[model samples]
Target chain A: MSPSIMTKGAIDCDIHPSVPNIEALLPYFNDHWRDTISQRGVHDLQTIAYPKNAPLTARPDWRPKLGMPAADANTISTQALDTFQTSIAICNCLYGVQLLMSEDLAAAFASAVNDWMIAELLNKDPRLRASIVIPTQNSEMAVAEIERVASDPRFVSILMLVMDEKPLGRRSYWPIYAAAQRHNMPICVHAGSAYKHPVTSVGWPSYYAEDYASQAPAFHNMVSSFICEGVFSEYPDLKVVLAESGFSWLPAHLWRLTKFWRGLRAEIPWVDRTPTEIARDHIRLTLQPVDAPPTSEQLERLMDHMGSDEMIIFSTDYPHWQFDGVDVIPDGISKELATKIMVENPKNTYPRLQ
Target chain B: MNIQLMDRVATDQKIKLAIADCDIHPAPKSVPVEIYPYLSKRWQDYMETYGIIYRQGFPTGPAFPKGQPNAARRDAYPPGGGKPGSDLDFMRSQHLDANNVQLGILNPLSCGQGVQNQDFSAVYCNAVNHWQIAEWTSKESRLKASLMVPYEDPSASVKEIDLWGGDSNFAQILLLSRTAEPLGQRKYWPIFEAACRANLPVAVHAFGYGGAPVTGGGWPSFYIEEMVGHAENTQSLLTSMVFEGVFERFPTLKLILVEAGFAWLPALSWRLDKLWNRMRAEIPHVTRPPSELIRQHVWLTTQPMEEPEPREHLLDTIEWIGWEKLLFATDYPHWDFDEPSRALPIRVGKEQKEAFFLKNALELYNLN
Candidate 1:
């Protein structure tokens, strides 16, 4: 295998710190929630969003003989931080917090998850940062959770699922964006769903592969909603990161959007700038699951089409095996582009890192 | 946007590219009464009383509100203010003759393929097929028609193919990407079988009023969502066709995906090949990698052409998808039509321009 591309000060933007089970979260949870969980027999609320045993979920070499993959900070540090020589890594916990029905319980669990990260991961690793998971079931509770976590500098952004109960750009979710913008936190829209709606507009997909591939369209819809609903215009300072969502589709989407927007501009006059300009200013995507052609030339061509180098940030997508070891950066990019994706772009995107 | 149009018009006046427009919708001048002669008396009465009972619960019109009347360009409407694509003289003056189109392939999407009543759908498809040749293709020698089939009933679909499959005017068989099931399933095999037997390529377009949402998840909220949803639906169809061994079973079948963007093709092919490599045991019938089958059998129409940023990325995508596989389509009279002159990136070489604009489609349809 090739040596790790991680230079000394590389920023690993996406590293999952797995919550092994609900019981591990009980200590951080309040007594009422603890009782509620016990009463409901909520043993292991581990989400099927990323199947625990799926090969893609954990690389063969990274899999632990004793416990779940990346279950603790030590596993993460060894497999991600040390291996990649990461100076700073962001922990994005993708649990079933959004899947919970009760708004109160969901909020409490989200808060508990964030607290557990601080104690078990963030505080232990000073180089680590975390995204605040919010209960999207209720926007008010979500904003409250954001407010609760805003004071902590360790929390860098708010993590969200791509396919939520409603389009994230709806005014109902504006309060969360408002709070994130107020605190200068970027929103990371991860490639997963709350399962409140079918992943596609038609209905449920039959296979895991279909479900996985469908995330691209979900991202496409989310981006459209955000742009058309004037989310970026409303919260101009906010930067939205599309985590684990592939980047290949962006250029075409932007092109089509710009074309349609020109014809449909009279209806949505609020969108004063071109769709491409708006998206370039606001949207950023990770590079680990860089869904480009498997050629260096093609990759370079894609970057050229992206119009700016600043839109992509370096990520390992650690423990979620998107690429082979040390090939975390896809082929086709030059050393200069690689450095931009690894260090310069992430630093530019996340003001907190500065 | 206005400036872009003005610039395009100026460029269009100068550039006289003889192109084969692959996708042109020919709507009835009024309600589809022209097809009544082709339909049985019972079906004609059924149409009069109940109208078309589409599988979808939503209204028969497009899911999203159109930006233009009938979702057509304002200039495309006839002098009498009837639906665009209704008046051939107007279409000739406005689009066909104006653009110097060598041949235009008609894809009639308004036909009742999504109707709940199977017999009505079959009759409607048959009527439209005959109507296309009678009203459009025969009237204009430069125009060619696609043979419509009642895809839900494969036997009826076969019957329709048998009727017009040998006709010179009918160039290919038309199927929608969104059908009762993925087009690759065993149930839809007969349609493919008939098409292959008739030596006709299957042209699968994006829109279908199938009860199911365009995407597998459910109905999308916005017009843009529904519009962009075409890519996902086409992806699912391609996956189903490839994984289900449809390509292997009917190696002679040729597929033309219209109104779907081709930029996603390279990534999709890579992802599928990767997955197929790992999950080969699940589908033993697929003899070759999915990409090989796609390159061999599939052709994508360029209507909503992928405009990659740096612009050259469009060239890269075309290179990956293979220049030979792209068929230039205008999606005429629609709001999102691509003018032939400005459709492709300026960076495309003369040979590639020739292939994309005219030659590739000519060879595919055997127009030569």
Candidate 2:
């Protein structure tokens, strides 16, 4: 499998491949399940192909515009390897494990999507690397899927959406992180459609703008829960990347959490290192929504705080609205930071790419 | 002015010497109805529909209608909203003589942006609140203020309120309007509890927009749409307090509503009286008509006054809502700020005017 023309010079950190057609993927899901993929119009690939010229299918009166167009496997791989000039492409999602394991049958969907994704994407191209999706809805299945895919050279990391129902740092999720640690795979937590539960314990919000802004607090809680839960302390080798999430809120979040930890340090005594130390040692963040785009002042501030370029990773979140581009990166940041985010940091995190 | 001291003594029997000006505002630069000539055009038709006829420099007649040029910026405060009588500097210029006003409450026009933008729209809100507090409130002790919390999320609102509620200059927890359910609704309880714990008074100031409409009508495209939500928010807030049992639960809690004219109290009590007799089974938890609880726990500011009715009706409106619960404010810089010296008399006699102007406000704000 040769590197395609799209992988011309740099590595592509974020790419999406549509899972086998939505209908075809349905039978592979477990029984006692509802078929929401088709009902939700998740497989409108043709309309996505030529968005500006495409005719509007869903009535404006019935629904708000479904945000971003879905991308198929071929479209994803070609863009990453050829158009982006990447030596390696990290395919973050085909079908997340939570969706495929619709009912009580988690093991079946976990194994099925794993096999289907590899055959359709990985086996076809060596330049492409994928995250092994584990069935987060079912614990045993989640561990089993990671173990089965652990030995695959084409697999790079373990992927899951940030869920509010259980903090990723809880004992319930330690096994998944432990498995990633054993396999030398980093953990990638990406943003998803709103959670099945209210994103907060509170009731629903009144508008879409409310929904987007709420993501920051939930993200803060999940990270703190991870820290206080001792997920980082227990698995020192595990590297965590908050994927496709904006990074601007980082300064305030770190400040608040660190400030609170001062008075409440007794409860989480196992966390011997300071929160900032833990963040620098085991965590990396991908810049999207370009929360704090690089400018002379912003770059200076971020560099001063995070201390190294390795803490930042460049991600386009391609096929998603609000994608950050190379041009948006501020000119004042040293080329060294750009090289690390654009090339070195990603390569080092997922050794399969290296 | 002498009656103000007598009534303050009558309400609580506690006597104190400190003088507090409960409502004082450093108004912003006015949007010259001429500079953005379009504002006058857009707002004019709505003004006329409400029967507002204009004086050359000011909107002279009617409670809500009519156009008027607000006073030019006097020597002290800068050219902004508010007529000469209502400007902050005007109050300061007379501060030594007017009840020796020791502290003035500072409320800014820009603080209304959250309600104007759908509350939790962006990080811009956090930045906006930060700038307002850091820049404006730093120098003035007279400006004991309230921090505006974006109401989109109860958690963010709680977080911010708890974070800044401790600032010495911040006096109250400001929310755009009351929640949809009564105050006891658990969803809103977090904000109440946070405010209670901080010992900060929770205030609901009516804004010109953003609420479920009173009638089945969608939001009107014209600015006239504002009139719809003003009273609607007041009624929702009153229902939340009484039926939601907020007063019963947090007896020590203080809630104030500003810019919501106080004239509606008597009529609302009558309506509540009819509803409680007819609908007790529907809201049995409310041991009394909603008005009984409102008069005990709620306070409203007086601005946008109606013409002089009989002294008895004026006394009836205040007595029905509890005279101790009325606060006087010159809604400085808003389109409707009435001069304290003028708006005060048209509604009540000299003695009652003194109570509304200084005594009630001082007690409500906990200023001696």
Candidate 3:
């Protein structure tokens, strides 16, 4: 049962529509790459980001008997869209296409994944929208993929992982940012890493739990990179969304960043405003893993420090096991705040949704 | 005469207010020269010739450069023209005498902790400890030292802890936030064990050369990340220590996280507890909830304090983390140093304020 105060027709900003396997995308690929992939015996190009056996990778009820969880569009539509009464569900595909070492192979895989998503999932639901996945290994190729896919209105945003070879705000990635801005696309940075480096600063963590929680600081570090490297100042219109990245750490993270920016603004002269101001204007986060105290009353107290209502967009993060059955919205969110998060915020964030 | 008596009583109360400053950074007046007296001629020559051994990434300056010059406040520079924290008389007048800081703990950062030569690290760590004794702690009775250690080498760290051996002048053992590996790895377990035996709580201050990327994902593009980024290291080490069962292995061992922000603690604990509840089977040693373990073992110093907007939200976070676990710090001489009088934005009651600024540090150090 949905909460009594649930808002109907809400926009679900994040929901993973599983790619069944490499075979699912085979039809989308050209014969040259398809034949090569088959001969090379490259069966699964998956990252440790969401281990298939990890319970968090799928809610037990959502998993099918035969195939991967949420592989069927109707399953997601019924479980995520219909169950929550959401009108729009943005499908964030976590296929690990970008993890390929060869830039050409990665770009080819990205194109194939986008094509497969369109024919498979978006075609089935009018309410579905998606983000274009890019191989960050080559920004030029990544840009070309964005240019190729931008014409479709259903591809509402662009997807980048929080952890990759380098910080997303580096100058090498600027060309892709320019393309994103041109298409009026928000770069959706989801909580997954290429695992090119250790999961935490000291070194690799032993448990999957530590690696999962490490995403909060990883998101925090990228936000600092974005603000200090003048990403916002250079593009002016570019927006970044942190999906499945916890927000409870954000208030303190921003406070620390804003303090340093004030003291050290002269070093990065292009960062004309405090990090908090820049983040409020340019950055947004998906609402999952609220990561607050148990009570909604306490969550309100924690969220009051976020400084703006518009920064959070609603998301169930379906099939991720972030929460239990049907408790999509955490308790203690006021009805007015819920409306803003579910309806107004997502619309304002993604202009395509309007 | 009646008015004069009341004024004297008020003055006595002001004088009676004890301010134990936990995180005071003391710099050597001159790098090699100041440490020479403690080092023997062989190591002294080695120090002069070789200098510091760092990688090509940051051979000359910091790889992650601090924002300000010497990472210090402009006014913090001594009038006599040394680094902000180098001169003793200047520090006393500018900070301690000025602010009524009665109990100041010296955490001298230039102890050659990052010098890649672990042998020199042991040599220089000993030199730095002696330098603290002669220059700061021994000279001023109100000031105390954190026994410096070459924490990169676990055996060296234990040696230094044993050398100081809970000397009255040194109140705690000083390790850094970043290290060659996570502090809890079995390699560094001996340091925690030694600290407990010496009856000294270990204070993990905010900066070091960990030989790994400052961030988990790799090097960030900017310098600001260096300032707030190590708190992420603090977060990692806390999880590492607890999950590795370091706390369980050494029950009396305590940690003072200096210059590591406390506002993030409640949220981090919540995340760890969630994992502990589900993944306890993977690590059978961690018997209780992480928050309970954290509250029992960890004490956080407030420096470069987090400034959440509407300010009062800090109160809610502090409530969750527990106010008693906080030790007020100045991070003196650093560019973003917090002043005790106005450090906290929220209203703290008189009794609790006393605990925050004074009693907490004293009790933690066993000084009171």
Name the candidate that leads on lDDT. Answer: 3
Compute fnat per model: 0.22, 0.00, 0.63
**Candidate 2 falls in which docking quality class?**
incorrect
Judge candidate 2 at residue B256 and give its lDDT. Answer: 82
Query: In candidate 3 chain A, what residue range of length 10 has the lowest lDDT sum?
Result: A289-298
Chain A only, candidate 1, TM-score: 0.97
Q: Better model by DockQ, 2 or 3? A: 3
* Residue-level lDDT for B283 in candidate 3: 77
Q: Which stretches of candidate 3 lie over 4 Å from their true place?
A: B1-17
| Residue-level lDDT tens digits of model 2 in B268-340 | 4444553354445545666765566776777877654433222233443455466677776655544444554
Give model 1's TM-score versus the native structure: 0.92
**Could you give the C-alpha RMSD of every candidate to the true structure, in order shown?**
3.4, 23.8, 3.8
- Which numbered prediction scores highest in TM-score against the true structure? 3
The per-residue C-alpha lDDT of model 2 at residue A211 equals: 33
Better of 1 and 3 by DockQ: 3
